[model samples]
Target: MGTEGGHGHAIDTSIPSAARMYDWLLGGELNFEADRKACEDLLEIAPSSRELALNNRWFLERVVRFLARERGITQFVDHGSGLPTRPNVHQVAQEVHQGARVAYIDIDPIVIAHGRTSLEVNSGTRFIEASMTDTGRIVEQASKGGFIDFGRPVAALYVSVIHCLKDREEPAAMIRRMREHLAPGSYLVICQLVSDEERVRREVTELMDQGTDGHWGRVREKHDVRRYFDGLSVLAPYLGDVTHWRPDSDLRRPQKSLEWVEFGGVARIR
Candidate 1:
């Protein structure tokens, strides 16, 4: 990602990237004015956008720790892994299982740019700037990169990003392809924006669809999300608002947005 950790690329600050926007929402300093404006617009629609991001992130950290410490997963392939934030996948996993290896996937140039310095923190990490839909490419790169092992259980994290795939893109189908490539006992951790309110779904979907400044999908219902786990052996505390997907502690941040939530859970491939 980003020319192997050296040389800077020209980033078009006029456009807003979802990764940058997310980093901004998390109170990070990796965003531009366009991203800030986009977040403001998003907040106008979903007032609890920041809280929702925080909750999803907390869920991600908690689930990774569980997988590494309890479930014994060491390798990870983060689909659409966004910009580097505090306690990333590798950092969290390594804390539980030292020498945990991770392959970060993202097509965003911004993410690619930052990943060179931020993600490649050790020999245990790698970054691939490719479509998450390209499971074959992901596997090949991860295997050839000499970090991730396909023969071992790998946690493929979709965490909060599937809403970027349009209906015709078939998010569920992409997951099935991932299952085909991954070893059994490997985990598929997924969660994305979902809402029961018809208005929230429509408006938020439309807003993100038009202004994400890149490929984007609609906010769907819970039923639509369940389709992604149709054949997988879902883990305990199964599919629901990720805010409640194993709280890990009562100290977690609260997301008051009933209008929309990051919904889905972890499932294992048999």
Candidate 2:
């Protein structure tokens, strides 16, 4: 197993991490007690959190398969890739094309540790510990590591993670930076928590911000997320609820959460 943490920071169980909380939501055992408790509190605010997480994960897999099988993309960069889960980006892409290469990027130490162990034997995959905003460094490292070729069409996936960025982070600008780095015809997969109800957006955002110690971003409206794909060619159905984005028959039963939903879609860089 290969595991490397950029800062070598020890895991702190005192603070709740979004990644660990997400793990808890997915019924994964890689989370700490703090994460579990935090998720419990989160569930109180957004009762459908677990359903949202599962649907978003399925959307990620579907898009990756589409890019690999339909678009013939051979390389992928999964930004903010959380703790290793079944049917990871590489696993989904490789199923379509065995030679496909994937680079998983995340700032969570636990994710890096667990990712390295899970991907160690896979020569075509790599786990990088870094902020997704560090597009240049991530692209450079993935290129230098020889797992991802920037010259070819690459799928840059922000899937369900952009909500971790604060307003000052300029998430849209971050997407633009990545788009500038990718080759033409490359794809960008994005989805984040959104709500039409002002109360749901405000309350959920506040709850997550406090629980994660301000490491959370506000739940945005549909229009705000739309700006992230400006000038790019969005895939069919445009931007809407992720649950309906090319759903498979095996998809879990939809959760009745009119409060909020995971929304966004894949777009091709022109």
Candidate 3:
């Protein structure tokens, strides 16, 4: 198998990383012990986090298919692309459009390591080790690397990742910068971990911040997430629970609850 870097950095298993924790929650084997402990602590506070993560992942797959197949978008940039699991962004998008190009960006060492290995063999994709906060460089690199054509309609995805931004990081502004770079026909797909309960939001955010050793972002309300799409046109089933966004008939929900659900949608640039 093609590979990039392999565990180049010292594996700091003392503290958790949102990426690894998420991998664990999704039943992936890329996580470390710190990730498991952090996830356990989160479960104590919000028992539905694992379920929410799974649903959000499914939501991402749905958006990729919709954009590649239904909307005919061929270029994609998945911000904060964690460790690659089954049916990754490029895999899903390329399934519908073989010419699809995907650029996965993330600063986490593990993600970068795994991304390099998982994507090196895919001709239409590449992995960039960068922070979402560095939108200018990301845009420049993506354009110069020949993976993305800003002149064409590209689907930029921020699935379940915005919460990793602290308020000072200006996640919205970064997205706005990216939006300004896209063509009118392009789409921006954004979703984040959300909760209507203030207590749930506060505790989980605080705990995660601690669990990750301050490498965490705060969770925002559902409305705040919607604000990112203010000028765009949202598609059908607008901004409901992600599981219901475009669920497959075979994927049965064994239980239903909305305490912590994926809430976001696809919006076309106007």
From the highest lDDT down, the ranking of the candidates is 1, 2, 3
Instruction: Write one digit per residue (lDDT tens) for candidate 3, span 106-133.
Output: 8878778778987868989978778877
Candidate 2 per-residue C-alpha lDDT over 32-54 given as tens digits, one digit per residue, 9 for 90 to 100: 88889888887887888898888
Off by over 4 Å in 2: 1-8
Clashes of each: 0, 0, 0
Q: Quote the positional error of residue 63 for candidate 2 in Å.
A: 0.9
Winning candidate number (TM-score)? 2
Clash pairs (backbone) in predicted model 2: none
Deviation from native of the Cα of residue 51 in model 2, angstroms: 0.7
> Where is model 1 poorest over a 10-residue stretch in terms of lDDT?
1-10
Which residue runs of candidate 1 sit more than 4 Å off their true CA positions?
Answer: 1-10
Query: How high is each candidate's TM-score?
Result: 0.94, 0.94, 0.94
TM-score: the better of candidates 1 and 2: 2
Model 3 scores a TM of 0.94
Q: Kindly provide the TM-score of model 2 when superposed on the true structure, using C-alpha atoms.
A: 0.94
Q: Once superposed on the true structure, which residue ranges of model 3 sit more than 4 Å away at CA?
A: 1-10
Per-residue alpha-carbon lDDT of model 1 for 22-96, expressed as tens digits? 888999998899889988988998899999999888998999999999999999998888888888989999998
